[model samples]
Target: MKILSITTATNHLSVALNDDDQVISEKNEQDQRNHSEHLDPMIQDILTENRLSLQDIDRFAVAIGPGSYTGLRIGITTVKMFASILEKEVVGISTLKSLAKGIDQKDSLIIAMLDARNDNYFAGGYFGQALTNVIPDGHYHIDQLLEEIKKFSQENNIDQVVFVGSGIDKHDELVQKLGLNYTYGSESQNELHAGLIGKLAVNEEAIDPDKLLPRYLRRTQAEVDWHKRTGKPFAPDSDYVEEV
Candidate 1:
């Protein structure tokens, strides 16, 4: 099966074309400001280089969120549109899970996280080669995540904890303070890799394009400000428009 996967959940944007287990072509760069402009062109470049078209793709996969709000929307919207128009299978892969898969550690706790700023993170924990979900994915403070990791590690008799994703860069010192045997992922492991996303989608069940949505773990700044101004909970689909 030919799978086209996209990852734009962070500053790093990546696109991959995979044929079954083989990655045919991939293009990636660090461009946080212009993901919308680069994503489609990268996709086209890969397809054209392979002598294929969008119609030839059998499945579409995308990183769903817990990163940049705008980046997530752009990637999900583009993939959904293509899948809907082509009537192809669509898979939404978790950004954290993709990071976890990038790490090749066995018999240890694998924690995949994205820096959510202000000492908080979007984190999920997995174990072993199958990437068993030991810690649920969600927004968490650095201290809270550390406590959970320590508890899970002690209780499960696991000695080492492997941390992956951009979050490691910020919280490694705090993780070290716990006095546990922990390691940080490599520079490449920290970046979002669309090839891993495609491999993960191969076994996952496909969902309708209409049902696909960005998995933003927290409310946007705009929503928070709106709530504070009106003293009412902000709904994403609410009938509120700001006049230009």
Candidate 2:
């Protein structure tokens, strides 16, 4: 299947055209402030260069959250729009899973994380080449995440742990202190690769365009502040208004 995948879950923005599991073309740029501006152009460039149009794509895939709030929306919304318009199926790849898939490791626990700032992270653990979800993806404090990793490793008898994603650089010292044989992902494995996202989507069941949604593991600052002011608990479906 020909899949067009997009990743904008972090500062890095990447788009790829994949024929089955192989990457045909990819474009990546580091632009935290300009994903909105670059994403559409990158998609167009890849399709145009490959001599294909939106209708030629058999499937559309996008990283659906646990990263930049605005970035996730941009990518998910764009993919949804295209898929809906073209009447094609859409797959929402997890940002954390995409990071895990980039790592070429087996027989070790892979922890994929994105720094959520203030010593917190969005983390998930995967095992082996099939990327089994050993650790459920969620927002976690540094201490809590480490403890969970230690407990899981001990229980499963997994010897080494591989950590990947934007979260590694900031928490390297803390992760090292865990006393487990662990290694940080290489430069290439740390960033979200759109090609990997496309490949991972190959076996996943595609859903309607409207079913694809951003999976932000935490509440936005706006929602937090709103709760503080009104003393009301914020829920995912809460109708909190964002101030412009």
Best by TM-score: 2
| True-vs-predicted CA distance for residue 142, candidate 1, Å | 0.5
Q: Against the true structure, what is every candidate's RMSD? A: 4.0, 3.2
Candidate 2 residue pairs in clash (backbone atoms < 3 Å): none
- Name the regions of candidate 1 deviating beyond 4 angstroms: 233-244
Model 1 reaches what TM-score against the true structure?
Answer: 0.92
lDDT string for model 1 (53-144, tens) is: 99999999999977787898999999999999999999999999999988888687989999877878889999987888889888888898
The worst-scoring run of ten residues by lDDT in candidate 2 lies at 235-244
Q: What is the C-alpha local distance difference test score of candidate 1?
A: 0.87
Write candidate 2's Cα lDDT for 137-210 as tens digits. Answer: 88888898899999998898877999998766676787778778988888888889899999999999999898
How many steric overlaps does candidate 2 have? Answer: 0
Those runs of model 2 whose alpha carbons end farther than 4 Å from true positions after fitting are: 236-244
